[model samples]
Target: MSITSAERRSKDAIKARIKKIVQKRQSRRRCKLSDEELVLLALANSSDQWLMTAQIGEFAMSNSFFQKQAAQFLFGRTSLHASPQGIGSLPSRIESYLRTYGIPVHSKVDDENNKVYSMTAGAAYALLEGSYKKRSKATEKKLTTCPLLEIPIEIRMKIYHLVLKVSGFRLLVGTQSLSVYDDKITTWESRSQDALKMPPLNNFLALLSVNKQVYNEAMPEFYHENHFQFRDMGSMKNFLHNIGSERRKHMRNVSVSYYNLSAAAAGARLLAESDTLQKLTLTISATKDPAGHFTVNSSRRRFSSLTQIPGFSSMKRLRGVQQLVFNPRLEHDVVDAFLRPIITAPKPSKLSRKKKSNKRKRKHSELMSNHEAGQPAVKVSKIG
Candidate 1:
């Protein structure tokens, strides 16, 4: 069965030439195709076809050039073959290619009751760029139907401000620790304990929780336009702390009631530091002395402490405090004594000035009279 040496050499030479010819053909085919051309060719052949992973492998196997190019495009590899077993269970690269061309592949039952894949008419048209026109028309219809989005943003914000205005004077009340005598429930607890059960209702404030955009638009109006009332400085401090620093910037008008010197000082310090505070209305409720009488001296001392607080003393340092209104108005003398030193221009003491002026006039008249009567005028020196 052994062949001659010359015959064997001749057969080996023929095999080498065949191999060279095949390689040349493959190289030529690869050079002829671009990425876009390969994609277009694959899509055109599979248009409106529900191709499974196995079916796509068959198509790749038929064309050696396509298989090599497809593997490069899909998996970024050059040596892989386009066969059912070679592609494995999931052809992710192939699926991506199909999806990029707008081919919608869905699974369905074939006539033999086996699951098979199919493409929709939309996918077929998408290959030819017909679907883009349809999508553009649908988008235009949606934009035209929604008239609210079409209005100018500036005008929309104005409408939001008007609609979100607080209905009445906004009074922010805090829970005092007291016994509840209600028929339904009786307990000695802070109102904050029941805060979870009964939440305070502010219709205007409800707008803040709607969504991000609405909250942003409505919050500034809510804080700046409405007057906020707090029972005491403590309650106001707590509210401010809870709202955090960012939101506290919008608060313009604040009303608080003070019952003691410490409370007034604390409240003054807080308001002094606020960047956007325009008006502060302080209602000083008269506190009783040990004798149980509302003492003027005690009220005066408390008001004095407020002006002396380090934060409140430097009024010029505050950015935007234009007005300070006191309720149950204090006497003019009391205001001039304590508040005017901090808030207003210092006027010379009227009584002292008047006394000095009168004394000068009397001395001048005495000198004139003495000179006219031919008596030597004696000057009286001031003695301590």
Candidate 2:
């Protein structure tokens, strides 16, 4: 029957907030609107509903500010002598006033040739008293949101580095999921670890779950930069099977201690698939002799222990590894045996080729110099 007091109060509150904003901004205008006219305009624009010129003009005409030429006021004319080019700028100026409070509006023409306006989803119009701080806090984000997809991939990768990269980070991979190993934690745990024990979780892995784009960009940063270590070659082989090829493609460095023949070989075979691998380091950390019939020194199990592992055929599969280093503790012959497969007949790099060319030129110069001096070139001997 009659408007409820709650409805009346809400109407008063919206009108008051809009009135204050419109009045304050319109105060600087050459032609200012009266309180009734401003309140009417503010209420008409407060909701997202469209307001045509005729409808808005009725409100203006009801007030003393506009008895005639309501159309001129609806158009851009701020004063009677305002330029014709100013048409449409008045509504935009009003919209600008609303924009200052984070409520923005957009306009379109209806079938009746009436220009109507509605709010854009782009704003959080928090005009109530307590809501000012909340809206103000979000203003910067609203202005600065450059979508993650829009960012250049190179810059995005650097950003990924900030979130995901860990310097000197060594992840201990297992048969399934694995824990991280700090430098303080040596790789000497018992072989039969409980599978139930949760592998320590890495926070950076959260980047993968953010979205597909971030996951794609972040994968290389986390996997490529960090060195992966294995307790034994056996675990590495199992991990190689389970580590998604997409992720494994980014891996750079890997180190595994020799504990089993079949595992070392099988893992090496799997590792050869990665063209991105830069280095492979094998450590001979086995304290006891393996179950092989090698006729080497019986007392020194460590040295002979390495040479006996028959994974050499599998070790050669690592064509992707730029450098293959063996733990210094192993005998040189043993290291060389494993090294031959991974780095045998290594492709010469530019620097090595340059060095070889320089060596030839130097030898030629020395030979010519010796000949000119009528002295036999002293035979150069390399003392091993």
Candidate 3:
């Protein structure tokens, strides 16, 4: 085991070099800024920006990568020791350092007597430029993966319909004066009335704007599922025109209110053009007297004119017509009597043929009886 002095010196040198490298690495690790320090630096650099210690702790905790560093800063060997009484030991230590650095601190006592800390103007600026911006970008990147877009198209459409479809009819009314469209003098009055209040459609519009493919899938579900109500023919016409022909094909149920026959006729004509419309609920406003009979002369006249209007007459031509509901306020039997001829199939002429057959049988029986009685043969004249 005996060694030369030169050999011993060489071995000693190697050991000393290794020890130095280990010491350097330890020093570097110890000197590294803790999460609390980074947060303080961030708050200090933000001029006039205030933050509570709890908020800082929350931020550090939420970013799990910084959790250990924050713990080390709060309770490590270099941290301050304070009494466990009054205002909390941890916060007291933090406050002492903030004061030592001459970093202006604002303290507010809450209802529970807990102190909240905030940075004032005198805190030293230590955070590097773009640090906050980088953090914000990182957070935003984490939120960009939307689960909604990942779902199957059929499921997404169902969800969209659930969200966008109205529970009942959606009323579309005009807020301005009405005007003629296509040179027709429609009975739909001035459109300058307050429309019925409705739930917001902004969410549906926002969903549609997500992308072109999403818009294509959701638009049909939104239009096809809900029943649309229009105050008059003019408003319905405007709505149809605005939605364009492509979307119009998805429209199915429509409810319209008309003050006059002309308006009803006009609305019917417009609805007749919609190839997809299956149900039409026509609401006619007819004022009644104390006896429950229609009181307005104009109303009676308009009701009679319903059958005469070209648009009203053409309702039979609507291939998709299924249900027609008149306002329940009017007499159902009376209305049915009038509309039965217009909308129902014509009856067969079986009653007239049965009556003629019975008469011929009666005449033959009488002639047989007379012949059996031995009466002279009476000449029977042919009845036309």
Candidate 4:
């Protein structure tokens, strides 16, 4: 949820009004408010409905010196001590004066046996309805900046996960990087559980564009956690290439079903090198003309084109988690051959590059010696 500029202006106006009332009421009480005005001001401004003396006092103390004058007015000194009488009597005095002025206070005992106070509904509504007397030093506002990066990394990751996780649906990303809409064609596709939990794709993706630090931290939480579905292989290639090859390492679960073969080769080339890809599903749509039939030569050519994409070499390797589904009409034997997984096994250390280099150096030295001695140089076989 977000506040519009108009909503923010309204909230600021309400705060200004409340501050004005607090100042006017303080003047009415002849500058001996015993902390009533300050307590009212704090309660009105707080996001929390109910707050204790310690919470209110902490709020007041953290504010400007002008605000702290209430505590001094109550304690008859600059600083307050934790005497039983000092802390205990302050809220009672504040509550007593506030009630007499018809600005109601709702009091309840917290688990700690201390008073938790909030404004009554009527008083709160009345505060918002009134007009502020005038703008002055008392109503000056301070802008607060959030220290997002200062938060602990573990906590930040939890926040990122909570905000970014989308389950039970695939993000239908197109050439625009994303395209979500209602289609009368499908029943359950419209009410996607996981995607709805997130903001609109554009809004959610804007989180990545915030700054380098936020982008670095949140990018993985989004890309790695969600299953992305593409309209065609071209969009998939565009998304991966535009985000950069380094970020493509996070491409885990992805699906693409395409009628056109234009993007097949480029998309496959990216996937071949994108060693981090865990799960992939590729569904090749049946290609045909408006008449819904293909000539023998055309069908053969079409099958040949599909096999060339990502090529047998790259496909025989793998995208770990992505399940590639080929056209049922296509040859299962050829498709199965391509989809077969393979991992490169390291060669024996004895056949390492250092030994190969040394062998070449030795052969060159021997040939030089034989030539100098006017003898024929023996041919050396190439190292396997």
- Tell me how far the alpha carbon of residue 53 in candidate 1 is from the true structure, in angstroms, after superposition: 36
Ranking by TM-score: 4, 2, 3, 1
Best by TM-score: 4
- Minimum summed lDDT over a 10-residue window in model 3 is located at 178-187
Q: Write the per-residue lDDT of candidate 2 for residues 130-219, one digit (tens) a residue.
A: 343454567666656638768898888888887775554466765455655553333344233333333245565776776666777787
Task: Rank the models by lDDT, top first.
Answer: 4, 2, 3, 1
Better of 2 and 3 by lDDT: 2
Q: How much lDDT does candidate 4 score? A: 0.60
Candidate 2, residue 234: how far the Cα is off, in Å: 2.0
Q: Residue 325 error for model 4, in Å?
A: 4.7
Q: Between 3 and 4, whose lDDT is larger?
A: 4
| Candidate 1 residue-wise lDDT at 373 | 100
Q: Write the per-residue lDDT of candidate 1 for residues 65-171, one digit (tens) a residue.
A: 66666676544463564443554534555456557764555656667764455543334334334433454578778655645435688986786777665444443
Residue-wise C-alpha lDDT for candidate 3, range 27-131, written one tens digit per residue: 433433434455554354332445555555555445444545655554453332322222134576777766775555666776677666665323332222233
- How much lDDT does candidate 2 score? 0.59
Angstrom error of the Cα, residue 328, model 3: value is: 1.6
Error of 4 at 99 (Å): 31
The lDDT leader among the candidates is 4
